[model samples]
Target: MPPTPPEPAAVLARPHTAELTGWGRTAPTASDVRRPTSATELQRALPNGSPRGLLARGLGRGYGDCAQNSGGTVVETTDVDAFTIHDADPASDTVLVTAEAGASIDRLLHALVPQGLFVPVTPGTRYVTVGGAIAADIHGKNHHRKGSWCQHVTSLHLQLADGEVVEIGPDRDPELFWATAGGMGLTGVVLDATFACPRIGSSRLLVDTDRAADLDEVLELMASGDHAYDYSVAWIDLMAGGRATGRSVLTRGRFATAEEAAPAAGPDPYAYSAGVLASAPPFVPDGLLNKLTVRAFNELWFRKAPVRRRDELQTIPTFFHPLDMVGGWNRIYGPQGFLQWQFVIPFGAEATLRRIIEELSASGCTSFLAVLKAFGEADPAPLSFPAPGWTLALDIPAGVRGLGPLLDRLDELVVAEGGRVYLAKDSRVRPELVPQMYPRLDEWRAVRNRVDPQRRIRSDLSRRLGL
Candidate 1:
């Protein structure tokens, strides 16, 4: 017998499945998924009323529910992907590129690199969208030098809750612009954005590697060596205790010139192949990724990189995203989807970091990947996460029962240090602590009130944090 298909107006609640936090999972909810092919269609689809319940979603790469709507309409922006490049002055070394809010950064980078241009800032993964980047105010390895992704933005096309399209820039609607940069889509629906792309010599990177004995050594090395390189990141051994605690392998790099790149052996000069996308079939057993296993992996990683290197030509993926090479890698943490905890502690809060690491180690919830980096100056975005401080990020499986309390303790430590948590990657932080971490919350709310006066825009994150 032939099965009947759902009608266009059928109100159905299904088990929604998509990638959130790198591990693809399903959340049971009543969400009307709408894919709008054009701006007009998008405007027409938004519910027409005050205090509307709605959310905009991009590539769904956020490690938490920042993009998810519990029982509201989820507007999938992927179909709105369209891009154009304008006449950019080479003398100024700036290229104006415009893309629909849903345009994938990875695709945009692939197009721009051929013209000797690159995105001013990119998160760890390139699968995110221009809108997502702006909503999160994402920073990159070069944040110490270039600042957050919002800094490169020139203009934005935003659709208000009442379905009015408005153009905004730094000089025009400056307050709304600043608020929307990290407003998490609470201000309005981003339709498109314009950014100035940075000119690069070549697609390859000239990388240097170094190893540090402990957390203190890693900080000193980064502070001393940061000026020499435009990009710097460290992989910390979270399980290492005592003298070896916070042992890390640091890699620093910059774009390479034609002379620096190896000679092209074939006709296709820039043909770099990426690995196929794969997913974990099912969850693995709990405790699959413990201290012992992670310790061994860290030891091997630290020993593998060449020590005190001057330069090495590597592909963008190898230099920027080494983890992308391994498909279904998240399965290493088992079926319990992992929670990524990324927090920043101010410059004088070294004790906070040490305490967090010690707590994680003692709790026996050591993460498989622990990253440490030094952030530079702060931007004006009220809800933006980055600041002048030291940041640490980790991935722990959700099945760890006591993990929530441990993270809460860490959050307290972070707040005491005058640091804040990255809302994009958070899942379980207390709502009360949110206001403490982000002092400008009220300012951001004011802007939201002006734009979405009825408080129409909403997401799971907003509901959870009482934003």
Candidate 2:
């Protein structure tokens, strides 16, 4: 589908009411959506402790219910999208920009890439908003090198439950700031943020691609050589069995310098384009992606990757957000939707990782999207998801038989090994395991209590997990 046309100003000014669902499309809820055009308007729309609570929703990129508040007020921040870029600091070689929470990363990229700059951290897709990035403390392929998105953020204005906007940062008000980072917007609504961006020579990346034979080889390859690249990730094939299980295509990259890219640069050495190339059909049958079909697709995909390719040039979209090209791709899973299960196990828990992949392969649940990456240090946010470990994420048809028990069992194994699932991508995790997964839950709750004393800011995720 083509993008929705911009609404007329008068019509845009009116409040919106709609049924909302997260990116996963598994859970849907009715909400009164308040599209505030400015920070002042956002503050005015504050719930004042509504019984159903309120949530600040961004571009709706969170895979789960973190952005949805059932039967409550949802403050959609996309209208407050405006940003101003500043000159780079010569000493630090970093440029700073203050962007309203509603601005999508795609918007920022369009403005920055041509100027030879890029966001310090990006998740798999660039469709998320600045506030959504900070809220999730999102990580990327370079997590082993630069860490999560919140680390680059300098300061932000957060509107508390009482509509009082406060400036907070790592040093100024570290407690509240960190609490809000990865806190899933429970503390307050983020209005705007000033973050540091790294300078880039071109909008292309010099990437190296390698095919790993199996689970063991892929793990060894990433652990031994990932330090050489600024970004690294592996597409693992969980359907492969026995000796070929976990066979993967590992791709690692560093930004291509202007000199290296000029040969094919045409007029603009830093030209960038990330427009969607295609859209998935509006509807698909639930059983279209069964184990047999997935296995065949996996085989084809695996075979298509080069066994060893070095320093190949690729655009930012191709390297970082290939999925963005296919709009509404999630609908391919059919009306039943799909569940994205993402979890991180500590560095020493490689055996657990192998076991999980093994179990999933045996489960017969179809999953074409599965990736493995190495995570470095965790951000100081009490609720930050990443840690020094290996994080794996995959999508599975929600209607898979015995899927519940299968994931439930995996949760115990993860907790036993001191790991936790990513809340942003979760849909069906049990509430009781939350504390075990996030040990600093109480510390975060304390800060949340001070900011939202009446618990005015609540999301379906918070209510579900009792955050």
Candidate 3:
């Protein structure tokens, strides 16, 4: 008997007026949030002629306004939950999977890890959706080995402005494919995509840990030793000063073998578990994350690391998504929210990196979550953020007395050094500086013009950066 056709998507829920903000919780904007359960409904909800256009929003994990549209329509894609995992062939090293735009990485890991499979690339958190990963072209600690997220993507199904669905891939529609890879949803709404996942021996990582005395030592250590491991990252102590400024704890690792995990993590080596341990109470007083408090936290964290350690078994969640253990952790920054400033300077620009760190330390900026990593190669996606360079990410409390000016100065330094900020984490970058930071901006715009001729798909970040 023929399989009955799936029911057509129901009429999308009416747009509701709601105040929306990114994960950073900064620059909240009012927009009509439209709940679309499927691709057909999403196409119906597209604002073709409305003064304020439509933007597709995933799990709202983006740190900035790239997924938001002020005074416009925001189509919530959470309901578009289509996911399927194909049985892997006995001879293959990869697993094939198909997922809708709204399926979060957390969901994928839960389904695949037990089967000895894992995503090719993942950011600091697994709450991000597959579509968000592609749109942002996010990289992970393994960027020095595997490229960005889109590198492993086989193809994507996109819904264009005219309500037409098209299949695009690197070879099929090279121009459009590259444009939308890191286009930040400006091109159209991503419906679904197929990607390859590598099989893993276990869910735990076998890690080596080391502590660096200062900035130069840390850089030298990472450069000299990172290639020996599949993944690498460094937790920097921004509050330290004098000889200790830029001190860091470096960790490098790969998936642990079954034998390695049995001795350390118990018998069920493939078992995966993650959950919120606590929640931050809302309405906390402002200035709760003052310099003194953050400095103390940084010191305690730095001092806790082992001077030198090797092959410590750590669960996937503990190693990759530590922050996810606490629900609503962002609230700890207080009501004013925070800004995640992430920028990348090319290999030879280490001097600029040192200068920025010195300025931040001197300015007494409080950032307890500062991290530094090295990127290997860049993909062809015009707007993709990663490159062969050093990338630093800092979480700063918003509305700091001189933060705006300080960030502006940092932007200047980055641009002068031929570096660029990650749009997925940026809320306040100058429009003129974008083109300089991303030399291929014109190419991406040309593709956007062809697909969204009427400029129907837009976002706050698009307008702010003049993309």
* TM-score of every candidate relative to the true structure: 0.92, 0.97, 0.96
Candidate 2 C-alpha lDDT tens digits along 1-467: 99987766765576666888889888898888778898788788785435788889999988889999988889889988899898765666689989999999999999999988899999989999999998999999999999999999999999889888899999989999999899888888999999999998888899999999999999999999999999999999988878998999999999889988777666687999889999999889888888889899999999999999999999999999999999998898899888899999999899999999999888877889499999999989989999999999999888888999999999999999999999999888999999999999999999999888888888899888888
Give stretches of model 1 more than 4 Å off: 1-29, 48-52, 264-287
Could you tell which candidate, 2 or 3, scores higher by lDDT? 2
Candidate 3 wrongly placed segments (more than 4 Å): 1-13, 47-49
Sort order, TM-score high to low: 2, 3, 1
Q: After superposition, how far is residue 213 of candidate 3 from its true place, in Å?
A: 1.1
TM-score of 1: 0.92
Q: Pick the candidate with the highest lDDT.
A: 2
What is the lDDT of every predicted structure here? Answer: 0.80, 0.90, 0.89
Residue pairs in collision within model 2: none
In candidate 1, position 79 carries an lDDT of 70
Ranking of candidates on lDDT, top first: 2, 3, 1
In model 2, the runs with Cα more than 4 Å from the true position are 1-12, 47-49
